[model samples]
Target: MTQAMSCNEAAGLVRSQGAVVLHTSPTTYDRYVSGPGMCLLDQTTEPAWVRTADSTQCFVGYRCRAIELEIGQ
Candidate 1:
């Protein structure tokens, strides 16, 4: 199983890799991106908050979510 990482580490991965699938818990994971360019045509980039080893809610990078979904939020 993938181990939890720090916010800085996660951010670094996104910066260097452009996109990454980060696992916050054993079953919880999300795809993070360095910028909106990585998102699909129907998706937009939003702040991604996740639990890290050193913080409960860390701002690592951006997450791609459907544009329509974000509009309702």
Candidate 2:
């Protein structure tokens, strides 16, 4: 089952495995090409984990289950 995790946790997971999508801009979210999870750039924002040494864009953590599923777990 999908779990409620901090953005920090999600960043780690995405960094290692990859996410279905990496939300950058709200309007651009749907436009992102569906492919391998985005590389978590060092966005200087919150959660601290996603922050890297290059990028300043930050993805604040989510409070809800960030992932959506089609099958029952």
Please tell me which predicted candidate would have the highest TM-score against the true structure: 1
Model 2 TM-score, 2 decimals = 0.25
lDDT of 1 by residue, 24-73 (tens): 77878889998999999998999987877777777878999887754557
Tens-digit lDDT track of model 2 for 1-73: 0123444544555455433344343333321211223423331222322332333433533222234445975
Pairs with steric clashes in candidate 1 = none
In candidate 2, how many Å is residue 12 off?
A: 0.7
Could you tell me how far off, in angstroms, the CA of residue 67 lies in candidate 2 after the best superposition?
A: 25
lDDT of 1 at 57: 78
Candidate 2: give its CA RMSD in angstroms. Answer: 14.8
The window of 10 residues in a row where model 2 has the poorest summed lDDT is 28-37
TM-score of 1: 0.81
